[model samples]
Target: MSNLAILPILLPFLAGVLVAFFHKNLIASRIFSIIATVIHLALTIFIFMSVQESGTYVLEVGGWEAPFGIVIVADPLSALLTMTTAVVATAAVIYAPKSLSRIQEEFYFYSFFFLLIAGVNGAFLTGDLFNLFVFFEVLLMASYGLIVLGNGKAQLRESLKYILINLFSSMLFVTTISFLYSVIGTVNMAQAAERVGEVEQQGVLTVIGILLFFVFATKAAVFPLYYWLPSSYTVPNAVVSALFGALLTKVGVYSILRTFTLIFNYEVDLTHTLFIYLAMFTMIFGVIGALSTNNVKLIIAYNVIPAVGFMLMGIGIFTETSIAGSIYYLVHDMIIKAVLFLLIGAVTYAAGTSDLKKMGGLIHHYPVLGWMFFLSTLVLAGIPPFSGFIGKLLLLQGGLNQEEILIVIVALISSLGILFSMIRIFIGGFWGEADIMDLPKQKPSLAAMTWPVGILLSLSILLGVGAEMFYPAVSSIAEYVMDPELYIESVLKE
Candidate 1:
């Protein structure tokens, strides 16, 4: 079990190397990428089950001990997220060959894709803060390659902005890590957690905590810091865009969860209160952006910001039920965002533009695509009988329990705006008369593209239907995350 913690990160790194050798053969590269992700997914499942049965698993690199040498830790939270990353990455690879241009496939697309996945897995499973920063760099570098894969003017321009913003965030992350290490003399998160509890200069620690919060919040695309996201995301092709929309920002939120729940938790009263307010602004601003955009990709991209806010709200509420709801929502959003981005990509592919005004009555020919878009929109809006509903309900219950009436109200109203924003896209892009006479008719392969969307949507539904069974597991993850002693013991013990 301890050894398995390294497989998720190692498989992808090795696969990336193997795929780089076959980059000229798109078919071989695609096949290799898919197989690698499938194996990673299987490994992640085994890790998840192992963590469930045994509590946590830690792998000390080179047999070096914790608080000194590198370690990989797979607690329930990391295991769940690693499994989700594998699932999403598998779908992206399966969808890639069809969505990517031939040049992209022939180049280093698959190589960088696996590199990105490896970095994400490493970020989730690493036990030390400095290594987490290292993984972030790995993923960000790979994303730089993937974002500008085709080298179009729009892709290059937007990719520059994405790169610059992340570069700045990376600098901030390093600075925060330095400050933290200077204070505690350790980068291992569990050890840092132990030292934080014993540190007497909590006022300085509180400032460091706030700085760390800002660093992670930037990656998560929280308000003010999120200006780079919608534009950066909308410029990429749907496959890359969908993958970023689904996974990247969530890693930031996951980092926030790890930091606030473990190392920097000495000042939750001060720190969590800030999260609650920022979450309110994040949701409101995100909805406003969605309401203002008629571009299908931009609307979907903007929605990702608010979903981050919702998860943060759960974190800020800081209850087991609320955190569990956030974890469940995180899983649901990964599937839903992928579906929405892919579906929108198909629409724009058919219509030859992302502008909703240029697209009309797509359902007349592609009824399956239209309905998938419609239902996924509702699932995103937290409609009843969908997975979003249960997660939102638990978050709201947590807010009410904490007497955060205003936060609850903001969340409720934001749901209305979310529904409105998505419905507008549906009516304009799918329901109106076909105005696409001048556009070229090179539609993407429906069977190829739509099947992946269908698979993701099915997962979304299953998350809702199976919530009764899954909730307990996420609840346990929440409990484990909130109390870091179990993680410390598991990682530090000889």
Candidate 2:
């Protein structure tokens, strides 16, 4: 069954290639994309279940040995993330047909979409550090194509900034990987994890670790490095925006979680401490941006930073419980963010604008959109009875256990700010007088788009209400990540 690890990557890569050929036939393209996503989701679920029941599966390429050949390892963490990516990407595909323009649909949008999934899955599952870099490039190139799908001027300008930053980040990643290989003598993650502890110049190793982290932090949009996200995220159409918002940044977070725990495990005192402070500041600055934004898209985009901060908090605390909370929180944020973006997209469609000041009293007319938006805000704010609350609760508990008083306070305060910003959106966009001037004369049929939103919203509810069932799995994943000895043993064995 270890071969199943490669299926997630191969399925999407092949499907995407096939979808590219159907670009001229929009109907065929749509059907193919939807079917492809559904099949991908099913396969991902099977892989997740198989991993849980059995153990981590590592597939060595070309019959080569460990630390010498490319490998894809499907551990619990990677499997869960891949599953979440599939779900979110599937939703985006379902929503894209109606949300995206005809030209955009016909111009290989589905191809790039599946390719992005392939890259993401490959990134999640690959055991080789250089292969990880390779996967990042694959996903990023796909993103570059996806972001400019419509060929709009705003999309081009913002995508340019987005591309430039990612390009720099990629260069840094390669440099760090090169430096790491020079220091550790291998580009295999498990090998590096074992070899890093034996290196003589621990100081140099630590510096390289920090540098690599900074590269990922830029991608994850930690404070001071996050200025490009909001503007670039908002320029794309809602489907593309939602996809970017949900999956792309999480890849960075996933990398951080993987590397900090796996390869750079020796310098906990220095590296993890840096994460704590960075997480705190990231939370503060991110929510401030969220509260200050008037554009609905930008508001949501800004919040992604703070959410990243919250996950970083768990990592900083660096306990099994804390790591568990962070994993749960990461998954929760991915789902809820997708829900929020799609909900906001629906409102944008109805109003023909994302400006909060120019829109009002949407609930009186489009009550479905209003209520869904309101509930999703609560989820985003970590209100009770939602998945967000469970994640927040666990993270808070983890922080308290670690005696991180300042971050706990910062997180609590940031939660309030998040609530305030989201409430502001609710009040400004969904309440008060119905402003028909800004709204579309012919309200678009939200029937198709709403299905995906509703599915995600329900899933968010399930994650919260069924937290007990999930706690064991999340706890197991955390344990595995924090202690990668078994992981390394499995990957290196014949």
Candidate 3:
């Protein structure tokens, strides 16, 4: 059992609570939040390195043991995601002080922000499915307050929709857990996987698998279930958007990735095949929404959906290269999406409107911002020499190797659509008639906004150009997914 494993979750919670006491002191609150996030990132990096050395670290809370008690498993997959969460959270926390209104700041914004990070970290580490549900609520409850911080009408309406959908999904999540526990007599994920493999009634487990997919799909906001995401995310300020865009939905994607690869692999022919097709349609529809939008925020929001499908396309393919590709894409997307939202936040801040038609000549005023958004567009669309390209190439190769021609063709076409939709913003916002509107009265200092965006975008470029450096880690993560025995043995045997 490792004490270090718990710190990613616990340290943030403690920092958040301490920040709450600084409600009357903004300087202290911001300083503490930034420090805590930086520390969390450093710790997760250290934990990730240790996990790389030993394969996995299983920590049983309160000296409890195995399936009988709470467990936190920091395998390569979870460790990688936890590290990414910390990095993204650090960016959001750094970006917040300049972006958030004084009223929003005076309230418990920093506390809520760190709480959200803690919840995300806990979700990544928890070995128990029930504890996973608890972490979900923790993050969602914190998000509800963050969403309504500006107290705007649009924020209230959209956040209510966001909350109700999550509540429904949470209820469904609990019911699924209860049913699974009744069947296996355990909610510990590693134990459940072991029991699931031994159970003869593959039919009921398939139903459970499908039900679990439905629940996570709702949160990941794939296709038909994705309507709430664009609207809800669009209402929040850029920092909140960056955080949610970078981390939240990835948790749902992570859960789906974890469960299917671990607990529900017995009926892959049925379950995975269904997931593959849904992922295909999700990409198609998501790109369509991006093309249909004039609002840059909605366009960015819709773009989030298509990438979700792409990441899962790798998972649904369930091959080594495919899974590795998805993991890379997941980490890459987190950084790039944060970069995108931060850029758009800068975009809307300078333009005074999210409507692309009302924006023009941005390239003249902010040449670096325009070029960054333009390159990010290329990255998002999987262009060569960019991060998205490597993952998309692997995914396409996997699909073709599996002779999933329809998915391959759909993925290629969707990339083109994604490219056009993003370029629409560049062309409309940066290249056209210089039809700029009055900038926002409360615009932030350019350096404050661009620093986070530039750093994240540099990381995205490094991710692509330096893909070889990440090859071993992503490959091992793929192995863990392909062989749950590695995960189960590490947890129970330890």
Tell me the tens digit of each residue's lDDT in model 3 across 1-494. Answer: 38888889899999989999978789988888888889899999999999888768888888888989899888889899999888888888788887888989989998898899889989999999999999999999888988898999999999999999999999999999999988889999989999999984387878987888899999898766888899998999888988888888999999999999989988878888988988998999999999998999999999999999998899888898899889989999999899899889988887878998888888877788889999899888988888999999888988889889898899999999999999999999998555355655554457888888777888888888888888787888887788989989988884
Model 2 gets an lDDT of 0.89
Count of clashes in candidate 3: 0
Runs with alpha carbons beyond 4 Å of true place in candidate 1: 435-444
For model 1, give the 10-residue run with minimal summed lDDT: 435-444
CA shift at 11, candidate 3, in angstroms?
1.0
For model 2, the stretches where C-alpha displacement exceeds 4 angstroms are 199-201, 435-441
Give the per-residue lDDT digits (tens) of candidate 1, residues 124-220.
Answer: 9999999999999999999999999999999899998899989998999899889888888889988888989887338888888888888889899
For model 3 the local lDDT of residue 126 reads 94
Q: Which of 1 and 2 is ahead in lDDT?
A: 2
What digit string (tens of lDDT, one per residue) describes model 2 on residues 1-494?
77999999999999999988868998888888889899999999999998999999989988898889999999999999999999998888889988888898888888898898999899999999899889999999999999998899999998999999999999999999999988888999888988885663388899999999999998899877999999998988888888889988999999999988988878888899999999999999999899887999999999999999999989888999999989999999999899888888888887888888888888877887788888888888988878889889989999998899999999999999999999999988888987644555676678888888999998988998899999899999998888978888989973
Model 2: pairs clashing at backbone N, Cα or C within 3 Å:
361-431
Clashing pairs in 3: none
Report the number of the highest-lDDT candidate.
Answer: 2
Clashes of each: 0, 1, 0
Deviation from native of the Cα of residue 341 in model 2, angstroms: 1.3
Number of clashes found in candidate 2: 1
